[model samples]
Target: MTSVPTPDPGPGRQSRPAPHDQRSRPVPRPRPPGPADEPFDLLGIGIGPFNLSLAALADGVPGLAAAFYDQRPDFRWHPGLLIDGATLQVPFLADLVTLADPASHWTFLNYLKHRERLFPFYFAERFHVHRAEYDAYCRWVAESLPSTHFGQQADTVRWNAARGLFEVDHTHLDEHGEAEALDRTYARHLVLGIGTEPYVPEPLRPLADAPAVPVVHSAQYTENRERLLAAEHITVIGSGQSGAEVFLDLLRARPAGYERITWLARTPAFAPMEYSKLGLEHFTPDYTRYFHALPEQVRDRLVPQQWQLHKGIDTETITAIHDELYRRTLDGGWPDAVLTPGVSVRTAGRLGSREVELHLEHAEQGTRSRLVTSAVVLATGYRERPLDRLLAPLGPALRTDAAGRPAVDALHRLELDRSVTGRVYVQNAERHTHGVGAPDLGLAAWRSAVILNDLTALLTGEEHYPLPVRTAFTTFGLGGPPPAATGTATRTAALRHG
Candidate 1:
């Protein structure tokens, strides 16, 4: 890796401003003969935060050649869901490289320092960063990293048995999102960080499809916020953080007594997220290992039972929603809003070109109802983009689980046929195998480090990244020997205890 100068903002000292040219430096675009002639050591499919984390960490490593591709023209993280005052669930330390390599220049602190906001941020003492600021920080890293190539959509990936490498075919899209050219690149290893897509449930799929009633997913909320607010009646579905934020934003925007809004969810209540210190240990690598070791059926059962970990609303958001409703009730009347839980959207259809009717059923009450609304916002969360289309050429080499999902190993590599020598790894696409932590921002850097270390181990027969000794205080299983005992005695003691 090339050596770059590090900026040291000494204790209680702020760094000087970047020069005009340095501040205005444009993102470097890869030239026409992109990685085709000279193959890269690593080639990444999508330039999301997960893969961007890998690129940022890989930058500090020596003799590692890598390139990342994305279909979009630039990096933007959930631009729509970046509601005002919305903060990330995780702290700033969970950036691209801090947890893995704090010394790296790509840290969020460095971004603040470079942008001349270090002192202000220090004074603010904000542990959880605002969503917009986090997006800007990621954009800063994506723009600075020379290895990232935007506007290139990877179409297919195939293993070249003769060359012992993977070939990726891509179409270079113009600013208009039109395909301008086609190209291919070869790499010894491949990493898929294609990320997730907004999911609309089957019952509401048709309404979300039709352009008549202005139905939109929370992923596109910001773009349609004004229209949604102007409607006579608006409904927000799902009980996750996104849904809560969207409902809160709309609630604050509309008049107190005139707010015609309905918030519905399949969950029994607007439950608070599991934010206890020890409860968070489930996101640690140790818990991930234990979860992966369980039987497939057990893993499936535990995921739904742990919904509060990832699916529940943040306490702050829930409080804000209640506070807003309470303040509106001061006028001797409740706000014109309905908040219901344990309700599922059975089906949806257009009442007219300007309105939508939803068939709803309550789980506990065993009752049914219909809601007519001018607009709908579905915040039903995201699903991992399937790799079937892209990996069609290598389909025969892929090993799948009982549910027909790809079997991702502990190192995040897809279980592939023995004949295929090249490795195909995944990011944010292994929740079934690695558990909920697979898509968590806090684990991005750690997973990236693991992938890099595994890659290096394959090449040099030695670990490149230092693995964490231990991450969680809670021991996940009873099969392990007591911490106090040693070696042979520990095994003897375990047998005796048994």
Candidate 2:
């Protein structure tokens, strides 16, 4: 397919600076495109931490040609929820390259050293670094890597059978993300790490969509915090880590005696995440291997039961919220905050120009009530970004499971038709098949190592990243051999369509 280049602006009008960052950089473009162009060895769709890990590891390979693209001006991990002093759920070693290759130049410790803060970090002796610092560490790796391209949105992907390659159509955008030109690139292999998006529940969708209503998702908490805090009363919905963080931030910011905030959750009680030593092993590769080899029905039944593994509140965050709320009652009266569990918001609407009315229901009591507040923050969590739109071109070739989701394998490759020889690998999108650890930060580096190992094995008949024989001390199952590298995966892929 031919790509139409952006016409010159005649040298008079300069494009304005892009959003997110003010620093000016060259307008992003892939190398020249035509029949004569050579396909990249690997092309990544998104530049989130998962893909950033892949890019960082790939940079170490002697002559691998790879590029990762994102629509944003630059890498920023959950900018809205980077609440002050909010630490990562996982330890700092769960950084981009540390778990996979600690000696790599892109390790978090190396980033600290480069910034001249290694001694201070050592003195601090911290395990869980702040989320804002984690964001900075990832940004450091992202910005330093030459293979990552910002401001480029991959539009669609279709296989060019004639070339035996995956063809990606992407758009280069101006400052405001207005498309400047359309271009296409070819890849021998494709890796998609386009991360999740903020989710708003059905009951609160209307208020969230209304322009005047102050119903905001926690994903935008930091950005819209001032507007929310200025109101007379605020209600926070959702009981996940995000909900807890938002509620605590608001509680700390509001004045002591008049702190009018309501925190609601559907859980029986505000619970802590599964952080016990044995429970933590669920995020290990051993458990992931066991989870993937389970029967489809069993796998489906297991994910919802494992919510506490990934969706529960941080124990520390929950404790901090309790402490802050308890501290407010020192003068012999409870602070004006209400924390109710086992309740859900049934419906929500704009009560007035600046307020929202939430209809609440208690699950056990079957009781209904209405809470009209000046503002509402939906601390509701995120959902995986659907791949249907991006994979439509290959719909016929792509195989799906009984529930209609993609049939991903233990190696994380889409179970596609044998006609499509090039593998379409996915990251952080296989929770159904792999288990709760699919999106965990601690697993990001391991997953990338697995991918790189397989990718190089297929290309050079040798693995690029050698993985540990085992990662978990606990035995996940009675007996099942863990997934080997691509040697076994190649054979499994061949039999997938048989």
Candidate 3:
């Protein structure tokens, strides 16, 4: 079998110029780098971790032209909340390329080796690595792939019936900081991984534009951390991982400094996620089947009850926060950070030059108000961007659930209108149809494999790479060695599921 050449590693996050002709050097022209006018078999909309995985999978496939585009000036995955002590919620094995191919050149292990930290990391015996480390690993992959275009945002995507292809329109600024609408690309398949936008409630939307209030989301916390660190008092809204992490980070910023923190959350208590080994099967292939087989009402009911399990922090992170709280208490600090559980921020407005007032309420008690100095960080999380904005031209042929999220096949292909010829796939936005694993890291490789298999099957009428079938505990490596008597049965069962 043939393989794609491994890309070279480099420092910094600048896009490499297209390969040059070595025979005779020519003067550079004022044109955008990379293949802008060229047609491709696949055009990925966003270069986040999900599409980055797909890019790795596509790298090994022959004659399968693909390129990814991102609006950011450079690749950055959650830079705002990469707190000094913050680590990933999932294992390091759940990185961009590991599960797809353990021997992948872009594996996190390879990244550690490149940085000469492999020995140190293993000695650490930590399943979860620092988020900063993962960010570095992603940047390495982005730097190697010269085909990726940064600072180029897709303005519009429309299906061209006459051309029998999807046309993507994008705009990027020139080196001089002048905006230019220079090109478009036609593709047989389009993968939309545009990610999500921070979700601010209706009451809080006004604060989104309030510069005085400093109503920034958790995603931008790093950029504004200095401002927040200088504040006398701050209020952090929401109780999810981001909210909790931000709260903790603020509290520990200046070990002995005086900075009051108010943590307003809707939940009665700060809950850690349920992540027992067997319980994690809900995020495995088996759970995808179990979830898909359940009745619509039952599935809907289960989602909210188990929301904490899939949506909250891992035990390690929870424990760290608990330890910090304990240490502060032992130091006689007594957690100047107040946890107003079961309370919600109703409205926020600027009080004066550097102060802000917030309307807060408790379900059991009457509504009340409070004032705080400096800023309010809204770690309210994110919401899936409406695919219809991109799929409107193709909406008539698309399928949706009662909640309006796209209805996708097992292969991750959108069930589109009959007029749609070539397939369109999605990632990071399938929470409803595919269950919790839709935006999960554990299933990134598996999802890519499924999508690739579907495409290959469409092209060659054969399954190229399929998902592994799950087996019972003893036989499938879940428990002991496979039973000698049912080895054949196990394989058959595995094949059936795949």
lDDT against the true structure, each candidate: 0.83, 0.81, 0.68
Window of ten residues with lowest summed lDDT in model 2? 1-10
lDDT of 2 by residue, 250-344 (tens): 99999888999999999988889989999999998778877997999999999999889888998889889889989988888989999999998
- What TM-score does candidate 3 reach? 0.84
How are the candidates ranked when ordered by TM-score, highest leading? 1, 2, 3
User: Largest lDDT belongs to which candidate?
Assistant: 1
At residue 377, give the lDDT of candidate 1. Answer: 94
Model 1 lDDT-worst window of ten: 1-10
lDDT of the structure predicted as candidate 3 = 0.68
Q: Best to worst by lDDT, what's the order? A: 1, 2, 3
- Tens digit of per-residue lDDT, candidate 3, span 1-498: 000111112222233323433212221222333334446667788888888888776665555666677766667888888888788888999987676567666688976776668999989999988889889888777766544556666766777787778877666755453555556667778888888778888876766655765668888998998888777788888878888888878877856435488788777777777777766766775566556556666767877777776667666666776787787777564766677777877877777767777777786677676656467888888877777665676777788777666787666778887687878888877666667777778887767766666666566665444345552232322334333443223222342354
TM-score of each: 0.92, 0.91, 0.84
Residue lDDT tens for model 1, 55-153: 888777666777788888778999999999999999999999998778888899989988889999999999999999999999888887767777788
Root-mean-square deviation of candidate 1: 6.2
Alpha carbon lDDT at 421, candidate 1: 88
**Minimal lDDT window, size 10, model 3:** 1-10
